[model samples]
Target: MSLRWRITLAIALVSTLVALALSLTVHFAYAYRQAEQARQLQTQRLELALEEYDRTGQPGLRSQLNDPKLPDRLREAASEGGTAAMVTQTPQGAVVWAALSTTGGDTLSLRSSYQPQLDDRASLDRVLLMGAAALIATGTGAGVVIGARLSRRLRHAAAAAARVADGDYSTRVSAAVGGRSRDEAAELAQAVDAMSSALQNRLQAERQVTADIAHELRTPLTGLTTAAELLPEGRSTELVRGRIAVLRDLVEDVLEVARLDTATELPELSDIAVGDFVTRRVATYSSEPEVRVATETVVATDPRRLERVLANLVSNAYNHGRPPVVVEVDGPRVRVRDHGPGFPDEVLAEGPGRFRKGSGGGHGLGLTIAVGQARVLGARLSFTNADADGGAVAVLELPVSEGEDAPGR
Candidate 1:
């Protein structure tokens, strides 16, 4: 059940228990008081009967002389020259009896019908039941109101947290103005806002450091590249050129990551067919991958960014995975699969991190760049191992514009 319903039911259960306890108490108390009053009235009638019998040698009207139906306990008490009263339940109803010993050695007994008191008690019970029902109903309604308010506040906090997770650092949760006293929901909202602020600052600092380092190296890197290019043609010189190229590429990847982190690279959205785009990009690779088009689907996205993402995936697959790489385009979804060892457990779990290379080594920035570019293009990219084929697959799903017909629609 949702938190709202749970809270509502909890309040309703408490209300039910309280109402039941109160109803029982009032029912028993009222019955006891009525019994007591009946006993008192019976005792008064017995006293008057005894007075009349002593003066006129005859019991008063409606009073019995040595009544056989009198309770044994009352009769025994009267025989001992003591007055006693008791209310006993009979087949008819409750009967309150009073008895005493007269001068003639006769037991004087009087009783009053308790049916009226019982009737009143029944009426009371009905009222109490109705009142308890009303109380519970009112409590349930109040619970619904309280639960809705709490649920709404919690939803606001959750939404803000989601936005923060999605890299919207400006999103913050705050309690509503004139809301109820500072509660847990308010505390949660405040905590989310604080966490977002801290995370935003930390990410900004990391991006700044990455950008600064990349900028500082770029000048020396250009000079070195120019000088290396001028250094003849030999195996040793080729090796030097290869190492320099790798270093330059690493610097460029870092710069790209910094730009992505700072959200400075925005997508230039345009209509593109997924099949054609994948085929064209795959042709540009050093070792061309097999391209398969299941259905030609068009999507609105940044073709340049999408190509960059696809390039990284294809490159990563070639460098780290066994050939022959395959790129499949199905509707707006593109899947690049390489027949090699799947991604590492950590990579699959927490995604690719910069400088964190896998078993088959590369700078590890390929997948990271792909993920960043996918995010900029508002696309969903996921990495997984093919269950049957036992190879790594990177899937990128680009969002189609609204009102546009899907493939085969």
Candidate 2:
């Protein structure tokens, strides 16, 4: 069940228990008071009957002399020379009785039917029952309203948290209207906002450091590349040039990573056919992969960024996986699979992280860069191992164009 319904049910259960307890208390108290009043009236009638019998030697109306039906307890009290009264339940209904001993060694008794008071009690019970039901309904309704408001606030906070988790550090949750006063939902929103702000600041500082270091090295690295190129042609010089080229490439990758971290670059979107785009990009590779076009889907995306993402995937597969690599385009979805050892468990679980190289190892920035570019294009990139074939498969799903149906449609 949702939080809203759980809270509503909890409130309703408590209301029901309280209504039952209060109804029982009111019902019993009212019944007790009625019985007391009946007993008092019966006692007064018995006393008048005793007075009339002593003067005229005859019982009064509805009064009995030496009544055989009187209860033993009432008879014992009357024999002690004092008036006594009691209310008892009978087959017909409740009955109130009173008795008194006369000077002639006889007991005078009186009784009245308590059915009328019982009828009044039944009416009161009906009213109390209806009142209790109304109370429960009112309480349940209030719970629904309150639960809905709280659930909405929580949902907003959760959405903001989800955006932050998806790398949109700028996302923040708005606080409640009345600045946090014992409202846990408002406090939760404030906490999410604070966490987002902290992460954004930390990431910005790290990106700045990375950009600064890459920029500082680029000048000296360029000078070294020029000087090395001027050297005489030999095995040693070629080795020097090769190392310099590798270093330059590393520097450029670092800079690109820093730029992606900032999330400030916007995509240059254009309409492109999925099959043609994949085929052309795969052809540019020195070792081309087998390409299969399964759909003629068209999408709006940045060709440059899409190529970057695809290049990274293909390169990673080649470097870490075995041939024959296959790139399949199905609608807006592209899958690159290489028959080799699948991705490590950690990589599959956490996706790619910079500087975390795999067993076949380069600097491990290839997949990380791919993920960043995919994010920029508003696409989804996922990694998985093939079920039947033991190979790593990278799936990239691009966003469909506006006013266009998805692949199946």
Candidate 3:
């Protein structure tokens, strides 16, 4: 049975049992009290009979056989369940007097030769049984009502939670006065709602990212193919090589993003000095690289991911910015600044989104790849066009793991 029915049935059964026990106890008590009263009446009748017999000296006193008052007393005693019987004892033996009782469900035998019987009230007892049953029925009905309310509220909450699980984060249970608020159902609903909102935000972000990826990938692919076709018969060495390099960069950018997106390449993070890594990347850059730092730091990070992150940023700046790019390391992050015409209003507004770039003529995959890599590496990436001049800045933050100390100034 459903929880509601089970709960109702349990309550009803318990109530019935309690009522049955109580009714039986009351019935027994009444029976005992009535028996006591009957016994008292018999005793009083015997006392009165002895008194009259003493006054009249009636050893064989049958009240003159027709004394109406004596016979009437005997009849009254019989009616009251006294079962009046006389037994004569002659030192040899005594005759038996019959048993008597006010009510009878079982027969009683007495020492005297007489018997009295009065039927017990089965109808009154049946009425009490019916009354107890009626009370149980009423209690059961009340239990059913309560269980129904509880089950209804529970069902409502369950439905709402299911909807949220199916991605409808806007789902909410109606908070009536009698709701699942008294149990885990309320907490479950709240959790579902929260999960739905989070899912919505993530889906939206992924959609935007997908659209940007398409746009960004199209550029380098098209440019690389065009550059190949444009080769006027056995392309010049320099032109062919430059086009090939561009193609390589484009392919690497896509691969980098794919790996990060799928988490195929996990960050093998470990303790590494931030200054040393940045310095190495700066040295690798052919263009004049400027480095600035207010603090030197060590952070837990995948060195490979760290290197890739720095490479993407430096490459993006090199391609789009003027010479003498300024890279700075402070706190838990590194920032690369390009002293060139910074990003356009659209690119700046889009933040770290895909298909977004500075004045770089190639695909916008560089920054896109950067963002994906940072995500896989469990870091943060952001970009802003410079307000001071024509410089654009890219910020990459590495989250500090437990037991890692802060930057040392």
Among these predictions, the greatest TM-score belongs to 1
Q: Write the per-residue lDDT of candidate 2 for residues 1-409, one digit (tens) a residue.
A: 9999999999999999999999999999998899888888888888888778878889986799888888889999989988899888888777889998888878889988888998999999999999999989998998999899888777877877887887877666764223455677777777778878987888888899999999999999999999998999999999999999988988999999999988888999888988899999899899999999988787889999999999999999999999999999999999999999989898899998888887776788899999999999999999999989799999999988678546765
User: Model 1: runs farther than 4 Å from truth?
Assistant: 175-180, 403-405
Ranking by lDDT: 2, 1, 3
Full-model lDDT for every candidate: 0.87, 0.88, 0.66
Q: Write the number of the candidate with greater TM-score, choosing between 1 and 3.
A: 1
Which model is ahead, 2 or 3, in terms of lDDT? 2
Model 2, residue pairs in steric clash = none
TM-scores of the models, in the given order? 0.95, 0.92, 0.45
Q: For model 2, what is the alpha-carbon lDDT of residue 140? A: 100
Tell me which of candidates 2 and 3 scores higher on TM-score.
Answer: 2
lDDT at 265, model 2 = 85
Candidate with the greatest lDDT versus the true structure: 2
The worst-scoring run of ten residues by lDDT in candidate 2 lies at 174-183
Q: What is the lDDT of residue 3 in candidate 3?
A: 83
Give the per-residue lDDT of model 1 (tens digit) for 99-143: 999887889999778788889999999999999999999999999
Worst 10 residues of 1 by lDDT: 172-181
